[model samples]
Target: MHRAKLASFAFPDRPAGDAMSVIAPQAAVPRPVSRVLVVSGDAALTEQIVRGLNATAQRLDNPHGLVALAVAQVDQALARVGSDGELQVVLIDDGAADLAGSGPAADLAVQLAALRPELSLYRLLPADAGGSSGRRAFDGVAGEAIAGWFDRGEVDPVGWFRILAAEVAEKAATPFYDRLKAYVALAKDSWHTPGHAGGDAYLGSPWVADFHDFVGEELLRADLSVSVPMLDSLLHPGGVIAQAQQLAARAFGARRTYFVTNGSSTSNKVICQTLLAPGDTLLLDRNCHKSVHHAVILSGARPVYLDSSVQPHLGLFGPVPQVRLLQAIEAHPQARALILTSCTYDGLRYDLAPIVAAAHARGIKVVVDEAWYAHARFHPELRPTALECGADYVTQSTHKVLSAFSQAAMIHVNDPDFDAHLFRENFNMHASTSPQYALIASLDVARRQAVMEGWRLLDRSLRFAAELREQIDATGAFRVLTLDELLADEVRGDGIRLDPTKLTIDIGASGWNADELARVLLERHNIQIEKATHRTLTLLVTMGTTRSKVSRLMDAMQRLAREARSRAPASRPVPRRLPELPHFNRLACLPRDAFYEAGERLPLLDDSGQPNAALIDRVCCDQIVPYPPGIPVLVPGQVIDVAALTYLVRLLRTQQATDLHGLADVDGERQLRVLRREEAAPGLAPAV
Candidate 1:
């Protein structure tokens, strides 16, 4: 039995009448070992060892129980081993010990034993420790070595019991596994098309207990085929899904809205496919989202690029300038539409009304990728959202700020020129054929929440952001970028006034790059901020933020500022520039043609000169978006730029590097496919 009090370990000879015994009666019972640590230098090896322990317990009808860490620090190992229900054993990975600095094996064992007198240590080395690349089959020779260790006192009774307990707990606590088992027992009808009739006589699916655990059992239970009543009807839509779309439109102050489960990237494609055709020109922002470029490819539109002023001080990208917008429109009189980002990820808000008016005067349509600024609609203090500013097509990520699940977004139609029916048709085509009812429900709930409390919540967020800025400024190590004071000045003329809710801290005074500061904060204090670049660290405040959390962050910032002030001022690096623009005729392939062709994946280095026809991947195991102001460097259906490639190469080298190269596709292992040379012949596919 586990003790209610851990004091028993320290005071084993306490009097029977003591208050400790009175409060924790269970302390009298001998404690069953609870905590454990399985260590390995190789991440893959550690995982395999843990898996083998679970598999062994399964064969013997034992519970597999143990907590594992891959190459942890000395303090972390000691802390875990020294707990009330302290760890019983440490599994040392011999291979990892050799790779890492030596002495960890013997040193860790001594430290763990000192921390917990009852704890034991287990040493695990590959069978061929000195030969054969140290890679042996776990079931073959490695398993035998492990079995021999089990026989010796080294593995011991505690190790065996801990492994057994882990398996038992895993089996008992999983709700998803239970739900899957229950579903199997339900009677089958000819109601779904997994197409196998729930694995009938010819094909029985092997029972996998972990499916529900992967994505929640309720979602699996609700994953009914289109024939099920939950989906209105994919062949001819009209039902609950359609109603959800209507609700989104109403809440966001739009005449019409389309639900896109595919994400804003695909929504962008649909907007272009429905509106533009070959020979048309689009007034494009230099700092445009990747999706907009993809739209240009699909729509066969020629883009008139409007250059944006790069903020040299911040080493950041901002909104397109008004002069450039006018210049582009004047230069390309045949332009049919305009597109831009309103509130940049760094929270910069562009003065778009004047630009919107200029485009509308020419009877041109406007589409704004307000993806990051989805919360702009609820607060009047925030810049007028695309819809409020009279943009023809406003694409927003309701899921982004409003708390809907990812891939749940809305395409609002605010202009008479936009065809609602056409937008819906493309939305359904690009989105999932098997749409989730829960996703629909989440969109509905987010919309309702935003309508009811968005303004009040945003107002609170604004105050919190302001307070944080003030505190950071008081320390003299950083200053918050505010549009109110800065926009009126000459030096900040190129910068857009920012939303009050955006807490963008300029760390120029601290003499450290934003990247270094970000790492320090997370490693030392366990606090995470948004992406940090050369000059700025951005923090986004939402309705979920509280004053206490802000205060803690403030304290941490002050401590970091103190540390940084003592260091020599960092040398400022000269600003970088974009490469010579690629020759559009030779570099880009029409999306319609690329869509019908097949290609292969190549490394980012090998991809130079070769046409890149897909969006650049950015995040860690997420859609590839370069975080602070996540505009893609390489857009889909466009050739990769040397300058953009250089930017990505530098990003990959930093501690921020998660993936090796920024080449592969976002969702899965599928490679980016561009049109082959044979498919790009004249008249085979016409271009703008």
Candidate 2:
């Protein structure tokens, strides 16, 4: 019998000036225990395997030892697997040769496979088990579900322990990140495009040396170019980049995954262009991000807008009514695609499974912009993500909630007939030719981190959010908006769910408007919130949110409440209310044509400082979107109406810290871009 020896864990040495050497001086962090669950009614066999694993850890001088837990009942095992995020492996003891011929044991195996596909499953065979018969049984019973089988008669217990450790380590590997780090350790001479030349340019000059010191040397050194063949090219990825994307696809439950260095904005455009062509009809959410409107214009798609419910008092917009969406789908049977944003900026998610099914039945592709819900798939409580709910294409801003750097995003494809060649052509059109290597590497590491520790991190975040909500409500001055409050009456029975991590607090009774509270929190307390509306403030409790951060925010709120109460009562001015969001208006022409046509900027207000009513009936040549929730009020080609103009005027008059895009400030007046009189005429046919 050949015996395998455990290798000592050590990093390779790098040269003195190497980037690795500069950053490698650090203390050794302790590793967490590798936990394995054993399913068997036989106590004696379980004990033997557990002891062997512990003894092997001791002999190898492993910092963190191995621990095996045995659960006899199937229900107990399932509970442990679901609750314990640290579990790495599962060993099922099939006493008889027939692993599948049983009651609870077989059922346990099936449940584990479905619940945790990341787990490494190994079957424990009897001592006398041998030959092709045992192998055949294992394969036939679970197929690829069972990773491998261990025969007690053939191998010693140490070998079994080693195999389990190896599996855990494999899950923790960051392919692109590890390779990038290794290449940096080489300290090779650089004649790269980046004039910094591995930061030597900055370091060599006395004037810029301070800047280099401030930014750190490792970042510039790791910023290598495609000239270095080892780091691989983002545009034509066949190496570690491909492997990383494959891992991400599996982790995110998609057929294929593509890394986006540019943000979900670009991802939205790429998907839209790939799916739609000139004159194609699309059903789009009226409250979608500005990027979706840009996509509609760029793709030359004629959009049939679906109206979203608006909370006028709260200054918020919710998801489209289920009845309205279904009606739109039925009305537009020739529509090529349906696009919507799940989990709106304030965290209201649609019941997407039925919606996806409805779209698919009509041969319409469904694209879900899940830019804020990237962390949804990691926890069971957040299941049924857009992709899991059968979306054809889903775009996620990984950097928004995950550990990835800014501008890092991902596009997941789950279409049955996904055109790889056509999709790649469109993706390359939006993708930068010279991509940032560090951003790509971050995407790789982000996937590994999410796969390994996401459940544990999200569990902590959910708990913190819950505690904060209760404590904040106890203040009485401010109340956290519950699921019932966030959902509109129209979407009550539509099976919509609000993400608990998003805490929207109504600050009406706090004696301060949302803008005032946000400013005070930032200026006095040095705390910045996610979004603020007229009467409500939205705070995102993500995986990165800590207990200390939550406590500080609560303390600030309590102090502000007390201060407001102590002050003498004054004549409180009535806060200005935002106008109701306008419904989808009839387009005078196609969005693409109106956008590309000759246009002139018209002042929103006339000389008397009143709204220029002349601009009301004119066709808009640009999108008028209010930032924070970057939803467009007037998309290109849409004819301006009283309701839409009122919304814009109120927003400008209030000056409520909301950014107005596509509307410009010219010669001390807010201007709206509109098409010429001839071009704005109605009944224009689609350009051939």
Candidate 3:
């Protein structure tokens, strides 16, 4: 709005005497515009548009706020975005265009054309006022070629702007992937890491060589190192990787996207490690993956754990009740971040859109671990993904749902306050120096596939899952978990829906527990599920899941359910419940402190009341994680209490394979590694 602000609008206005900020100045060139800039004109509807943009900016706490530049002339509008590319799409007043190339609008168009050159400028006529993203009913849609480039149509102005912005970004970015492909095709000399050297050099063993022959030479060739200059480095990707990330950012509706090869775990850690500092408070979902706790330990942030509501019917953790979550937010006003588990392992999730806004309003960063929801945005029923919900940070395990190789993942960043350098530093710290090139390429291909064929693939997946659910319910032995079950509370309050691609099966009333049913499927039949809880088995219906496979899975489940009912006595396993917390557990010592403290292994006591107050109050110096979901029950330095201890003990009894990391349970003698409290440690909150 003010001429004095134009030059500095690209950078945030520095507050006078505001000593320091957590955010470091970044090169805004690599970042997308999170806010919109509206240039005013004489049209009566200009004010409404301006209001809409400003309201959105305020709502999202967009790092870039609204700037109403009142420019009577075209030069002023050009001046707003010319020197600084910080301005998002500029919306000119309605009917303000003069095709004659003489009026203010035409003058502005000429300047944009002369400067930016190839920017796609589309004109859309709206039938009526619409919502944000400007989605509206099209009356007459037609295309008029502009130098065989421009097309005319009537649609949502907001949607058009987003599409236009993405196209412009993609066009401007260098094609790193194309160059890498070209380099791969060259089939150059054997040079880099991995002693095999592209599977060309024989190992001098017939069996090993035969294995290599079977695996093919391309596997090793594509597993090239970062030394290959043609395929740019991921850590400092200014080339193809950056372009891929930008493409991902747009595809995922993010301001920025960072590719993570280690999986969503590393992505989760990166978000926390970058945003939080030592002693800072972060609101955490009690049911979050253990990696979030690992990030907390690494960052030295204090966690204000939110309680999870246990689903009695399914024996699973539902979302932290919104009322309870809001109360936690109100309690910890100074929290640096709010981390939520968007969808649980069994497909239970909350509509975090409203929560993100609420958390953002309190100046808290929002991070959602949507690790199981990489394909959520492909369909409308699975709408309002964490990215669409406006979370500051969202992590997805692409391989879990998409066709990418295992360990290929991505982090979508949409926050204005995100520190890219800080994130990269952590990412580099965790990422391998000799990265997997094939996985990286797969991520690129996966992103493209999702962008191109996602809708059709997801639609098919939904049909498959829905049909199986209906068929399974008809068998009478299993009752399928519905979106209605998870959204009962949310639907009544907000319109947030569930991902139809994930199926949660309930056999709580049957003779078989989840593990028993899962075992039968894996051993008797050749079907495996994503995860299993006490009373439910979770199946991930992905893009690759076919109708034939769905039919087989349904048939197997029905037969197994009928057999269990007839052959086995009806005995229902108790639904797992979060243990009631103790005073010491509620007031956790910092996880970072506990993680670093000296610890000694001591025999674990089964009786909760038998452990001395000294033992219970002492900081835990070991991670006590349960298998399956592998979430931490007690992280290092946190006070160990009856509830957490009890939960862990139960978990140890029921937990199966996949590495029970950080636990000290050996044979029948349970042991715990706890912090050896010194006499000189700082005082806690006087034991409440």
Q: Write down the TM-score of every candidate.
A: 0.58, 0.90, 0.72
The digit string of per-residue lDDT tens for model 2 on 1-688 reads 2323333343423235644322333534446766888877767677787777777877875433467777775677778888887787898887733333346444566777667666778877776555677656655446556777787545466888778777776677778898999998999899877778888888657798778767667788897877888877778789988888888998898999999999999999999999899889999888887888999999998888877877766777889998888888888888898999998888889999999899899899999999999998887777779997999999999999898999999999999989999999999888987888889888988888787778877888898999989988988888998878887788889998888888899887777867888999999998999888777889999878876688789899899989777755574334567766667668888889889987888998888988889898788999888874567888888889888888788787785677888888887789999998866443644311
Candidate 2 deviant stretches above 4 angstroms: 1-28, 60-66, 94-103, 113-117, 123-146, 149-156, 204-207, 571-574, 680-688
What lDDT would candidate 3 get against the real structure?
Answer: 0.65
Q: Write down the worst ten-residue block by lDDT for model 1.
A: 615-624
Clashes of 2: 0
> Which stretches in model 1 have alpha-carbon errors above 4 Å?
1-220, 223-225, 230-237, 484-496, 566-688
lDDT score of residue 512 within candidate 2: 83
Displacement of residue 327 (Cα, Å) in model 2 is 1.6
Name the best candidate (by TM-score): 2
Q: Candidate 3, residues 164-219: lDDT per residue as tens digits?
A: 44544443333654665677678888666777787766545765866665666567
- C-alpha lDDT score of every prediction, in listed order: 0.58, 0.81, 0.65
Name the top lDDT candidate: 2
- State how far residue 666 of model 3 sits from its true place (Å): 4.9
CA lDDT, candidate 3, residue 197:
81
- Quick one: ranking by TM-score, best first? 2, 3, 1
